[model samples]
Target: MSDGITKIKEEFDKKVAEIKALMKNPQQDTGLLSNSVDFRDKNLIYSNSDGVFTSSKDKIENYPAKGYPYKRGVKLSFSADGTTELEVEAGGGDDLYGICTDIDEFTGMATVVPITNNFTGYLTFKKNGNGVNPGDKLHFNAQGELEKNGGNDKSVNAIALSKVHKLTEELSIVLASVFGNRALKGN
Candidate 1:
C-alpha cells in the first residue's frame, strides 16, 4: 500500500539523520558501532561539543569567553567564576587548562581544546633568559607563553619541539604529559 511505503520511507530518512548525528557526536550514540572493536581500535578522532575533531582521549568543550576573538593557540584558563579567561599572570595557579581552538563571534564562545596525552597540536613558545633549545622543558610565563623551566618547581607543561635563538623568532612545542604535573619534585 502507498501508506506502508510512505511510512518505510519516512523511517529510512529518520535513520539516516540519526546516523549523521551520531557521526557528529559518536560518544552520545552508544547504540551504533561504539562497542565494536573496529571502532575502538581505530582510535578515531570525533567531533567534540564545538564540532571540532579532537583526539578520542580529549574533549573540546565550549565555554563562555570572557573576551571574544581569542587568537587561535592562545592558552586559556578556567576561572572560578566559571568562564574561560585569557591568561595574564605568571605561574599564579594551575591556570593552564587548555588552548583556544575556535571562537563563535555571535555567541562569544570559545572551544577549549583540552591538553591531554593525545594532544599533538603545536604551541608557540617565548624566549627565556637563556633562549630556548629543542628538548627544553617549558612552563607558562607571565603572558601564558612557554618559557624554560628554571628548575623542578614550575609545571613542565610542554617540551620545546624546535629551537629559538632570537627574541623575534618563535617555535613550536609538544605537550609534556610525562612531566606536566605542577611541582613534581619540590612538593
Candidate 2:
C-alpha cells in the first residue's frame, strides 16, 4: 500500500515538473505577414527615339536588388503564457529602408513604410534614429513603441500568461486535493 502511494506521488511530481518546464520556456513561432512594397512591380518610364536622342524607355526593374520586394502587411509571432519582450530587425538590400510607423498589433501585422534613416544592425528604431544604419534590425521591447504597434504589444505582454497560469494553477490545486482526499479515505 505504501509503495503504491509513493508511486502515485512520484507520478504527480513528474507531471508537475513537466508543466513547470513548459511554462518556464514557452515556444514561439515568428512569420513575416507582409512587406513594404513591390518595387519590381512598379514601372519606371523613360522616352527615347531610334534616330534622335530621346528619354530612356520605361524599365520595370525589381528593387531591393537582393531581397524580395517589401509587401504592405508583415508580422512576426511570439507565443508564451506570460508577457515576453520582443525585437524587430530589417535588412535593406538596395533601395529598401527600415519601416516607419507604429507596428499594428490588431492582426499581428506590421506595416513598413519608407524612411530616410538607415537601420543596419540590432538597434531600437522607435525612440531615436541616431545609431540607425543601412541594414540594421529593429528591436521592439514590451512597450510596443517600435515603428510597429497593436498586436505585437499585446502578444508580448503578461495578459495571456496571467490568465492561462491562473486557470492552470486552479486546476492543479483542485486535482491534488481530490487525489489526497481519496488516498486518505483508502487508508
For this target, which candidate reaches the highest TM-score against the unseen true structure?
1
Give the C-alpha miss distance for residue 181 in model 1, angstroms. 5.9
For model 1, state the Cα shift of residue 73 in Å.
8.3
Tens-digit per-residue lDDT, 142-183, candidate 2: 322222213422211111101111123212100000010011
Question: Local distance difference test, per candidate?
Answer: 0.51, 0.27
Against the true structure, what is each candidate's TM-score? 0.47, 0.17
lDDT of 1 by residue, 1-79 (tens): 9999999999999999988865755576676536565534332422443233355656556666654323223345456
Best of the candidates, lDDT:
1
Q: Return the number of clashes found in candidate 1.
A: 0
For model 2, the local distance difference test gives: 0.27
Model 1 gets an lDDT of 0.51
